[model samples]
Target chain A: EAGVVQSPRYKIIEKKQPVAFWCNPISGHNTLYWYLQNLGQGPELLIRYENEEAVDDSQLPKDRFSAERLKGVDSTLKIQPAELGDSAVYLCASSFSGGDGYTFGSGTRLTVV
Target chain B: GESVGLHLPTLSVQEGDNSIINCAYSNSASDYFIWYKQESGKGPQFIIDIRSNMDKRQGQRVTVLLNKTVKHLSLQIAATQPGDSAVYFCAERKGGSYIPTFGRGTSLIVHP
Candidate 1:
């Protein structure tokens, strides 16, 4: 079975520029999540989708960040007018349902200059 | 709000020895706990999980112990190997919550 997939394994953007990351979840998985991991820290949930509907997104920065799972099979995370502190590894994960073990993508390492 | 935190930032152990990683959580409502192992350049992979109702759960070579009274969690790896070197994180999910809160993480270094 294929694991969760993410594009642009690495991204570098200047401060104030815009950047986007994509994620493709595993087939038949009903839950998808976006997380941010800074250096020497564990992954923190940015948003969660339950079959195309965002169930939780309190941690996302509303001013410059947004995410969508239009079809529920894939999702996108965007950060506009990025800041240096936004540099981190963005991880995408999928699970069968709530509270299930997650299968994570390799992640996109974002570096804001 | 639930908060998961690791007791140590780093641990060094000799190969073939056992290693123990510890975590502390703040929410008494949290019922589900999980351990994840993340290698360099990769995301976290599930290692083992234990529910609040259960004190211990064992996987292939790993064991997770949870103490709800003190909100302490631990992962024990038997006969640790070089391949076991990685960052380990403990996460918790409350009874009615779907999103899990993660700890800061502990880096395990196994030296041969």
Candidate 2:
């Protein structure tokens, strides 16, 4: 079985440009998550979805960042007018439930100059 | 105020030796814990997890120990190999919560 899949393994954009990332989680998994990782830091949770419902997104920067999981199997994270600070790795993970069985994608590395 | 942090930023050990990574968490309500290993240019991979009800759990060559009293978690790798070199992070979550707080990660360097 394929693990979580993400598109555009690497992306480079100038500051103030809009950027988006796509994720396809493992089949049969009911929970999906989007995380951001900066250099020398662990991945931080940006948002979480449980079967199309975003259960947790307190850490997400609503002003510039938005995410959606329409079918509950795939998700997209968007950052409008991304800034230089937005440069990092965006990872997507899926699990059978809320607590365990998590599988992660290779992630999209975003660089904003 | 929920946070998880590692004791060291890096750990260097001989290829055949064992390694222990430590973490401290502030959320006493956290009942579930997990350890993840991440390599360069890749996302984190789940290593092992333990619930508050249990004190210890083991998998393959790795073991996770939870100490609620001290709010501490540790990962022990036996006979560490070069392949084990990666950044390891600890995450904790409470009952029914979908979000887990992650630590900064400890870089393990296995020397040959």
Candidate 3:
């Protein structure tokens, strides 16, 4: 079985441009998460979806960041007017349930100049 | 007010030796904890997890320990190898939340 899959392994954009990332979670997984990881820092939860419903998004920057999981199997994270500090790896993970360990994708490295 | 942080920013250990990574959490309501290993240019992979009900949980060459009293978590790797070099993060999940909040991470460098 394949693990979680993410698109555009890398992306580079100038500041103030828009950027988006796609993620496909593991089969049969009911929970999906989007995280942002900066250099020398750990991955931080941006949002979490449980079968199409975003259960947690408190950490997400609502002003510039938005995410959606329409079908519950795939998710997209978008950043409008991206800033230099937005340069980081966007990781997507999925798990069987809320408490289980997650299976992560390779992640999309975003470089904003 | 809830946060998880590592005791060290990096750990350097010789091959064949054991490595212990420590974390301190501030949330007592966190009922679940997990350890994730992230290689360069990749996302984090779960190594092991321990619930508040349990003190320790073991996996292949890895172990996770939780101390609710002190709100601490630790990951121990036996016979560490160069392949074990990576950033390790500890995550804590509250009872009602679906996602776990991650720590700052600790870089583990295994020497040959």
Docking class of 1: high
Query: Quick one: ranking by DockQ, best first?
Result: 1, 2, 3
Candidate 3 deviant stretches above 4 angstroms: A97-101
Clashes of 1: 0
Quote the lDDT for B63 in model 2.
94
Better of 1 and 3 by DockQ: 1
Q: After superposition, how far is residue B108 of candidate 1 from its true place, in Å?
A: 0.3
**Fnat of model 1, as a fraction:** 0.97
The CA lDDT of each predicted structure is 0.92, 0.92, 0.90
Evaluate model 1 with DockQ and give the value.
0.83
Taking the tens digit of each residue's C-alpha lDDT, what string does model 3 give over B5-102? 99999999999999999999998888888898999988888788888999999999998888888888999999999999999999888888757788
User: Which residue pairs show backbone clashes in model 1?
Assistant: none
List TM-score (chain A only) for every prediction.
0.96, 0.97, 0.96
TM of each candidate vs. truth: 0.96, 0.94, 0.92
In Å, residue A43's CA in model 2 sits off its true spot by: 1.7
Cα lDDT over the full model 2: 0.92
Q: Indicate the worst ten consecutive residues by lDDT in candidate 2 chain B.
A: B93-102
**What digit string (tens of lDDT, one per residue) describes model 2 on residues B1-112?**
6789999999999999999999999988888999999998889888988999999999999999998889999999999999999999999887777567788999999999
| Chain A accuracy of model 1 expressed as TM-score | 0.96
True contacts kept of each: 0.97, 0.87, 0.87
